[model samples]
Target: MMSSFMRKSLGQFLATLMVIAALAVTSMPARADALDDARAAGLVGERADGYVALVDSNAPANVKNLVKDINDKRRVAYQKIAAEKGVPVEQIGAITAEKIIREILQPGMYYMDATGAWKTK
Candidate 1:
């Protein structure tokens, strides 16, 4: 039989593990689904120039906020890359956007044109 102290420690460890597993299962899908749903619904689209754009002016508040959050994160990433490479932030953004559009965009998703129009691919 295990000592009382060992049993208590084991229970605590198991509880912590359960919490971590629960979080991992629940948190990841919501973020991915938010973006996927927003794109599918035409609320947001990838731009040819290498940024996200609001496709629908009347999109829901959550979708609009999501776009802003993603764009903000992208800006930070672009800044980091630009500093590392000694290039302009806009240049980094443009290059990254091109690569995302070309390699990461999936079929039947929405994307923006150079003329500021949304198109489905």
Candidate 2:
């Protein structure tokens, strides 16, 4: 029931919103814990080597594709986490790195940095 002008205006507004969303996604930061940092953070450190070995063990094509797919999914997941945490998207990498360390890293492994520290939960 809308007029043509109204529909055109609405379409333009939606296009603008899409452009803005794309820009936001592309401009977001790219820093995240490599698996090592997660271990250092006391998360899953014990299993780090084993995980890597599994990845290196001539994984099937589907497994490799799944890994790539998961890595892409992690970006969106971390973006939501950043928004929820009230941190800039650019800083989400560091925050998530710490989270991985705390949540995933295992104990009794050496993951020291030059600063020689870990934030224990």
Candidate 3:
């Protein structure tokens, strides 16, 4: 028969092993072509998250630099627009970024074009 202390230690070790296995399973990557499969299944949240992950993981140095440049330009543009429209710069940034992301993710045109590209409704 095992000592009481040894039994408790063994139980704790097994519990820890189970918790580690659970965590590993939860964080495992999806199967290959998982993004395509998710899109086919109409899993928008999964697809978007997967796409964002892919872009973040595989983006080149130059593209990452370009995105930073674009964001800097956007900050300047937001400040100018906010000043002209008498709106708070933070509010302008929030609303404009939302609208731009929405338009790109789900296309449509509004009165003011963020990209200056005339998009038809």
Best by lDDT: 1
Best by TM-score: 1
Candidate 3 local lDDT, 2-51, one digit each (tens) = 99899865654443343334323433254324432332332311121111
All candidates: CA RMSD (Å): 14.8, 14.8, 21.9
lDDT of each: 0.66, 0.41, 0.39
Locate the minimum summed-lDDT window of 10 residues in model 1.
15-24
lDDT (Cα, tens digit) per residue for candidate 2, span 11-109 = 544433433344245433432233344324333221211111122336455445444443455456546654654545545444344444455455544
Per residue, candidate 1 scores C-alpha lDDT tens digits across 15-114 of 3343334323433577658877888777788886556778888998998888877676666665655565555667656655555566656777788767
- Report clash pairs, candidate 2: 41-101, 42-105, 43-104, 43-105, 43-106, 44-104, 44-105, 44-106, 45-106
Greater-TM-score candidate between 1 and 3: 1
lDDT of 3 at 54: 19
The TM-score values for the models, in the order shown, are: 0.69, 0.34, 0.39
Clash list (residue pairs), candidate 1: none
**Worst 10-residue stretch by lDDT in candidate 2?**
46-55
Q: Please report the TM-score between candidate 2 and the true structure.
A: 0.34
Q: Choose 2 or 3, whichever is better by TM-score.
A: 3
